[model samples]
Target: MKSNTPLIGILTSSKSDGSIAGNGPLFIALQKKLISLNGISFVFIPEGMEVDCINGYSYSPEENCWKKKSFPFPDLVYNRIPFRTKEQEETSQLLFSRLREKNIPFFNPCFIDKYELYQLLKTDNTLRDHLPETILVKEKNQLLAFLKRFGGIYLKPTQSSKGKGIIRVRMEGPSEILLEGINKQEIYPSFTQFWEEWNEELLKKRYAGQEEIESAEYEGKRFDFRILAHAHYDNYTLTGVGIRHSQEQEITTHIPSGGKLLPYHLFQSSEHDEFFQTIISIIGKSLSEQFGFFGEFTIDAGVSKSGRYYIYEVNSKPMSFDEVDIEERKIENLCRLFLQLINAYPQEKNA
Candidate 1:
């Protein structure tokens, strides 16, 4: 392999994703590591990719990865694309196809469906113990059975995040049913009323019926642990953990939906530390084996009021949170993993 700086392209939704502003400095960490080879560049590969005319953004506005001009494809790619970027649907697919044809090393080659993962992981002996009872909501019978058995349940969309389309249902009696949504919630006088309205909606979109864990809470809000993990050599390393506390009376602790993100250390006094870490290790390995390749994942897990730990969700393309330390470690690992991948796939021209 020739000695030359490798360019790393980060796939993102927009040209100026200020959300990633936090990791801007850490990109320099990559440059420092590659000083002997020249230096490294962090580029943002945005939506609306043009054929052969593909353009990317540099961390600075004046570089080749900037939006000012078209640039050559990078040596490695880190897909940060949100599965729901409706505007870039067709182009994104084409771009990925091209990347594969070029043999470029990239992670998260495709988006993962929540239902697909729920079914696959929940069956694993190692992961099932930490997985809450989750089932795809295929019919009215399933939802009713879960609510009746668990007394409280959640209907979560199989393709959503940020707590969108999460409906909390609880039965007070045969006649009284509570239906809680994102912005507003209500109680129906009868099961018939709740079923008539909700049945049609739930049937329209695929959902997962999850037994709601009355999680351990601090103050008045329920919280879940977000374990940020990334692939390291042959194993997964925990970048860090952060706590997402629910909004007052909210069913989910998604930060965008008003949930609070506290550093994981706040829960240091709890006795489940080892369990939580173990769960992360198992999941990271399990997902890697299942998916073939994974760069990073955010696991939404928490401890129950009864001291049981359960994993609620796994995000393959997790967004960066606003925490400085966690974001730094996450970016550091990303660059490290990119170097590993890039070095392994040296240019055939040089080979």
Candidate 2:
């Protein structure tokens, strides 16, 4: 028997006009790919408004009555919610909970619930080995100790993306550490110097916020890998891989920090070929078993001078597609994998 056709809903944030932010370039790419598939319909949901379940699209509050149409309910939701403030964060959680109670299939139910990801990884010893030295602490003593032991470290907000609110600390000498803002690049000689400089930068002289210190190197040119993993049928596959190289003095390879994305083949060499394949396989297995959410995920990983790959952070919802010279087969494989996952849900549920 043929399976039921799936109606996928993309839940995204609204612009000031209340329309969906679904027209972004990356999102457009995904939409185009999905549209190419047979028997699939796409619906959109914007925050702060109830969508109509008759039509497949909704209108913004700012639009005139003619544009204010109700959209149809979706069989599955692809969450693309962006959190800008504490209240928006809470609102997203509530919306996700409602979707769950309604029994709608969703990928990345809520991005704000990253604590669950951390908790899942904490118990996996083998997976933990691939991660860098990490700890959660709010005390200055803990930060100082981390800096002392690692010689260099990165201070980042627990809930930050695109490398915002990140600071890098490097040991300049036996007794001094150089602290610099990730974006501002303001330099300081010590923690006390950092406080003074930070106060001057903000012009209010107050403690900024909680920052997690991570051991990251900034002196050398750094590159990061974007490992795209997706579930196809019952197996998970690593789709297109890409590299991001820092073009500035930032310790991170995030695009916002003046980084450029390179093709995955750039890293494929006689020396690194074997290592790269092994790491990708390990990452795919780890994520599938840990999260239990079999969908496309982007894993950002870094390589040290010692030739070891360290998992930086796993992004549950990665930027969809980029305009690169990727092979047609790769793109087809990715699209096929996405459809496979969408198709597998009902079969798995029945079994």
Candidate 3:
């Protein structure tokens, strides 16, 4: 039996390649799932993208690209815009304003901000304990002041990802400061000298000072959990959890930084499995409620030696899920999220 299935648009930063597979493999799996479920799918870019002024494109399954078949604007938008500054671009912002004017429902209402998230969640009694001491470094003095208190801290670019621009710092003595391994562990005689040369340049860019969190280690390397969580409106669930072990020289669990990914089930030493899921579910739900209408996220959480979990970071525009069998399940969950969103759109618009 034929039915009027609602269309879904998978959006990202990749430009049109005149082929169907424009948005990458994650969406390919998602597109298949949507089509199998009797829903239409098309991938598009926001740059130079005309939502055709209330128009859309068709998914050419053979070519794996949207190509140029005319349709209506999608019933829901799965925004996968990856760059931190993409939303800040005039054209991108214009696109968002247009989407709003069109009254289209989209996931991830706002871009992810590391410091902004901490400030918002700090008041939550359930999550505050898991957060490390984090503050924005608007002035050279502010970062240095934080250092004096913490003894050692990490300076991170607020808008950066993939463990880039992570500077490890500590004071050698009252007048001396040590910067760990940017080039080499260099020592400065005074904080002012350190500020003029290093801190001054860093201050020009937005950074946050966080107390160095001592995460749980396995086999002599520090490790953390990359828990995959999904939300359908207000309902949330912990879908997947993987452990990322940091490299010996650095303190990040990012896969791009030479960190290794391991299945959570394979880790014999992890805290009670239920404990990890409980923490991730609570954190995930808080984020979904704070920001409305989203499907998935990667909550980067650390475990202390005592098996207590701490949430270090969250990725809204997460890297594609790579675990075995998890990808298909994510697409299934995503379709459910879209179905609920599509069903509720009219009521939301009327109300």
Candidate 4:
């Protein structure tokens, strides 16, 4: 049967040294499966350098660049633009806007649009409840209030990812607080100390702007859930659930902070089994209907000592697969979702 499956163009950042980012081993398995499917072709578009022309026109330049005027307009775009500086974000938004105007189907249609996410949350009470006590604060006063209320809070840039610009503030007592970077080991005894040290470090090396942190503690060990979800055609699937447990004195469960990933089932003690299951089901349903999320995305969630689960952040674009065999089920689920998407759009041609 003749098909019209669109060519899927994946746009993602290249390695700092300009090499093509290899699909991780887990994704390679899925890629192999996708290639054998009836309709669907994935083409990688590596990040390219933007150069200013002599006439003030900036263009993306490559060694063997095809003129933009002659290149094929992609029918489907799998956007994986990693977080960048504010200026880079603006440029990326402009590029994405152009693609949207051209009517290209995007995996995450507009993740960069924070207003859309906010709007979705506002309308859905269930989803909103599951999220952390998040507030968009423009001033330090609002941040201070949040910190006071949460005791120890996490501050993160609304659009940042991969644990960048994530700061953890621990309330030691009434007047004392400890602050640490999401990835770094050093700790500051107070906010003032953190600011001075952070600023000094920033002067020595560039970092993203400050972020509003979310704070929560669990067990004697602080941890967070990395739940992988996907939307395929009209169905939403929870592909995997893993908990990242902080190692040593780290404040975050981010892998860069020496955290280890454990299966979600580990939380299923005889006492909390039903409770855990209920929360997972509730979260899955709420996010699927609210976000219209398609393809793989991840959410970081934390549970307090009192058993209250709070979602820290949601990554609209999640990491491809990981090394552990435990990820096999997730890979399979993702592959199935990809196949389902292809089946739904069977008329489109593979690239």
- How badly does each model clash, as a count of residue pairs? 4, 3, 5, 14
lDDT of 3 by residue, 177-255 (tens): 8887533577889888888887655767778788977666888888887777777566676667777877746556677
In model 2, the worst 10-residue window by lDDT is 202-211
Off by over 4 Å in 1: 1-3, 14-39, 42-53, 61-67, 85-88, 269-271, 349-351
Give residue 337's error in model 1 in angstroms.
1.4
lDDT of each: 0.72, 0.55, 0.71, 0.52
- Which pairs clash in model 2? 52-71, 53-72, 154-214
Cα lDDT tens digits, model 1, 50-122, are 5544465454423423234455566877776655653247776677767777777778655666778877787
- TM-scores, in order shown? 0.85, 0.74, 0.86, 0.68
Q: Name the lDDT of candidate 1.
A: 0.72
Clashing pairs in 3: 19-65, 20-64, 20-65, 21-64, 21-65
Error of 4 at 238 (Å): 1.1
Q: What number of backbone clashes does candidate 4 have, counting pairs of residues 3 or more apart or in separate chains?
A: 14
What digit string (tens of lDDT, one per residue) describes model 4 on residues 1-351? 333543445555445675445344433454444455533334343223222100111122233222232124444555655534422565556655555555554565434333334445546665565555555544445555666776766555556566666666666765666776654545456656655555554333333222233334446677777777666454455566677878764556777657876666766555444434444455445455665445656666666556665655666667753436446766666656655554454332222
Off by over 4 Å in 4: 1-7, 15-17, 22-27, 46-75, 84-104, 110-122, 171-174, 182-219, 269-293, 321-326, 342-351
Off by over 4 Å in 2: 1-5, 46-69, 84-91, 112-119, 193-220, 269-294, 320-338, 347-351
